[model samples]
Target: MNALSIDIEVNEAHLRQQFEDCSDIVFRSFKLSDGAMLLLVYLDGLTHVQSVEDNILRPLLFNGLPQGEKPVPSLAERMKREWLPLANVQTVDSSDALVQHILRGSLGLLVNGEAAALIAQIPGFEERSIQEPKKEATLRGSKEGFVENLRTNTSLLRRRIIHEDLKMESFTIGSYTQTEVVLAYVKGLADENVLSEVRKKLGQIDMKGIIDSAYLEEWLEGSSYSIFSQIQNTERPDIVAASLLEGKVTLIANGSPFALILPITFWSGLQSADDYFERFVFVILTRAVRYAMTFISFALPAIYVALSTFHPEMVPANLMISIATARENSPFPTVIEVFIMMFIFDALQEAGVHLPNQLGPVGSIIGALVIGQAAVEAGIISTPIIIVISLTGIAAFTIPRYSATMPFRLTRYMILFITGFLGFVGFAYGIIFLLIHLVMLESFGTPFFRPVAPFDGRRIKDIFIRYPFWIKNGRNKKGGQQ
Candidate 1:
């Protein structure tokens, strides 16, 4: 409410009441030529200073009013067409529009006698320029990314899809923050229930701010307590558009680099945008490699523990002899040694992520050499444990979504704990428990483990090894089915 004031045909007293408790507000009394009333407003950065001087002040002072003013129309209409930067403001009786205008980065101008005041739309802002998506990059697709500007991000989608049916619906979720959020999906392709569920969940959020899509996403889909992110987060518009085409819903919020792709299952997380970029054979091979890595990231430590501790004969005879010889000098039990090494490996990975860009590689090198040499020298852990931990870290990195790797990282520990206690049975129990939890999870009311649990063969074209482009028909047949 930082507006310069002069009420011409408008109630000055009532205008004051509209902005009563607002402290940032400023007002100045002014006059128009030939005894006519006039008011001007500059709400901090909401009104451009230059535009106010040229469009508003200069016109009122220099540019003669409708010359023979027969009482300029309504206050709102007069200011909208006649005033410079204040063109788009709407006037209301209950102070709602004025309040809404102020909140939306516009300044309101009130005048005496006239029922309406000028509301100018001049949104000054600081936002990042479009850049390559850091998290969701694809070799063969669009390089453009979602910026902080919500309108600009939506425009990015419009540019790509270019369909009138591809709708972008907007709303504000936070109570105090008044953050803007938009939902984009193809009209007929996207499920109404999915969209409704997303909107309902977002409306239910009790938080004071919506700084990132993850906040809305966490509130909207799956359990907040689960380790896996039930909603897929991607920055690529192509990926988002693809999801929309397949009846998946997308949530884009102001001030977030990523968009939320709903109903993201375990398999969806494993698949990447790049999977569609490559040929069928290569895509399937890469998919298999990623699946194998998921197993490695989770079960390797437990399986190793199980074999070394309980089933020595499980390892080939030659391999068993070598492993036993290596562990001969180790002072700690295999379980403790394995657990400690895994902890160190995890510490190094987390540190690498959080450290300065320059220090990240250095931390990795230090973790590799310093830990390996010391553990082997002290006989606290065998050299082979270092290899296992290193491989586990690499396996976790293979998955495209970094967040998805976290659950597997957690799984690795559970697998270790289980193996340490009940050997193979505990390992099996952990895996089964994880599957049950995943099956229990639903993203926007759709099963998290979609195709596999739903047992739909038609969706396999896009799920497992994607069929050739000609054979695939470029649609998810199961998406629209009940």
Candidate 2:
């Protein structure tokens, strides 16, 4: 009794009634010669009206059947003989085929006394053009990004790879939303273990709707609460193609502008789109600056906290008394003051992101001038703390991937908390904990801390420094070889 039951006796009228609210469904009746009755229903966006008319309707109406002929054999023979490559029609006894056909962008044909309907699988979608990337925009690289279409996106992949081995498999997920998801990879390039793992993870995501590629990333990635993004999400088709070449599998969702690239590590997040476009020396210097900024974003406040209470000897003699005098009238501890300022800084950043473009500049001006100037003038905070907070905010923006910067933003607090309680020793403990946690993480079966934890000198050449293109040796247009 626990098993699910199907209501087979439910007529087309009942099924139509159940799905009447769905605006995309179009049900049309086709009464052929020889008293043959047929019902057709298809989705508006998915199926083309022209294919329905030419291949299916016109043919079935003119050359459907003879007056005294049996239905099954005649219909089956016509389908087998007449429809060349395009029209793929199948016979269905129960309502399952009709349901599936309608869901899969096919026109369903139901006939009287035939015990079945002819399900014609014809999917023709009008997809939009690829967009320009938003977050990862590059002045020197290709500007074209991905759009909210799977076929168009796949075609973009095809344009990039152009190899016979580049393969794509399609599936529809989400019971109600019916989102189209594609699994794409170069066949011979991708490792079988990782490919199988990708398929397995995708298979397990049973949900109501997939609004974007980010949704799929959250559902299919290894951890639920991990701060880092295990599945690399990119908006550019070139990035997708590049990742595919490197032996990574990409999951492209129907309504998502971003595609998911697996086996991404910390170094991948640090890399920008312009790295390959610019000269290697520029790339190396910019990368070093970004790394320095990352450290400053995380360590500046903690250093201030440590110096204020525990490590006063570290500060210059002239600067120590000014800082001490600034805090004399303040009620909060140094760590508390640092935490409050950091929280306000993050709030301003969030507000700037959410507000209209016109209002954002005003928010920045008010935050920078009114808050910092007024707070210092009012003697509530030291001028030095204001400078430190400003520097930290600027440093965070240097990181190319916004998500990669999140770990540092979070770890800053750990540093502050530890520096407050146990001074330098506690700060060291926090760093060890972070490094160990990063080591424990895996990005699609690849080490999250790649080339560092394993100590590969060849990989390290490109890690901290970007060598010249000739010195770059090989581009792993296939994923792991590089």
Candidate 3:
């Protein structure tokens, strides 16, 4: 039967059977001063042993109930009202719920004749201390980042936005893991439609396990096939608080250090945490340079290949001569040279990422210099091709978000191949196709390329330039505050 029995022996037997072979489960049985049987169930390392000893056990075994007081109708109520010295306490009537509570690091107490159990909140498992964000570091903003503990992460957000409007709804995902996922948003600021969509998508997830925030990210995205990430992720609590103020929804999963933000725009990927903290004039200039670098990183290789192969006349005479002379000794065409170097460059980058931290940067830098010089000396690749690929790699690092840079980096090769075959026509077609795809994309019902494709003049300024906080007024139509 799912319901707890009035007999304590039956309940203890069922609980022990449910936790069969689990070495970590702790069961403490003793007799109260009134000669009544009592049982305590908790996880060994998860529940706070010191609190249980001082609060529940000491008061019950030594102090007993108050003298000359009328007896309560039920033992569970008596303990809850006058005996237990814990802050949070609740009662569960079913075996399943009692087991669930015990598994979540709570202490469960069973009385001899009662059909209910008292659960005390005493989670004390070890967790990492809060540290500065490693991925999105900012010089001026707060250095604190989210941690794996769900309550700790929520507390971080609470410390930033101290308002009653900030609401956090909880959900339990993963049948096996039973991981906790929290959805955070402001009451009046967040759009009801977007919030509904997020809830619907989350309900549709039927996964067996959710190990990290990325697992939810994959399921919550509008399109699975799109290269661009529809939801933005950050480790900083300030970013999450800012997104909530702008009427966006955020998801924080248990055992994950990153939090996911939804209904993001194309321009959001180009923006950085430092932009909001810096002066508006300086930020505008930095953003302009970043945009230019993004373009060069994506299209530079294709443009060079098309001009050298089919539109050589468009190039300057002196540069054209130099390129031709460099490729004279190379056996393969310009396209092959570019492709080979690109593959090697990508391999080196991957190796660097997987290596130990101390060796990663050193290995990538030394490997690139040695490989490039060797390939050029052997005449397998032209000097000009190496320079072009190097410039493209350097320019790619300028993009603020790593997820945003991936699409451009991957698509660059496809455009290079097409341009090599069909010349300038292929380059133009590729650019047009990319723009159309972006315009058609959506993030939880909000346009992915908003303000630019739809031509919103008021919000466009925030894309290319950052206006002073005093000058900006009201919220954008979508999920951003102007």
- Cα error, residue 35 of model 1, in Å, equals 3.3
If both were scored by lDDT, which would come out higher, candidate 1 or candidate 3? 3
lDDT of 3 by residue, 209-233 (tens): 9999999999998798999999999
Measured on C-alpha atoms, candidate 3 has an lDDT of 0.90
Name the top TM-score candidate: 3
lDDT of 1: 0.77
Q: Please, what are the lDDT tens digits per residue for candidate 1 over residues 89-183?
A: 56655455566666667766665555556667766655688888877767777789888788888888888888899988888878777888888
Q: Each model's TM-score?
A: 0.89, 0.85, 0.95
Name the TM-score of candidate 3. 0.95
The candidate with the higher TM-score, 2 or 3, is 3
lDDT of 2 by residue, 123-157 (tens): 87777666678778887878888888777788888
**lDDT against the true structure, each candidate:** 0.77, 0.79, 0.90
Which lDDT value does model 1 have at 192?
89
In terms of lDDT, the best-performing candidate is: 3
Model 1: residue 391 alpha-carbon error in angstroms: 0.4
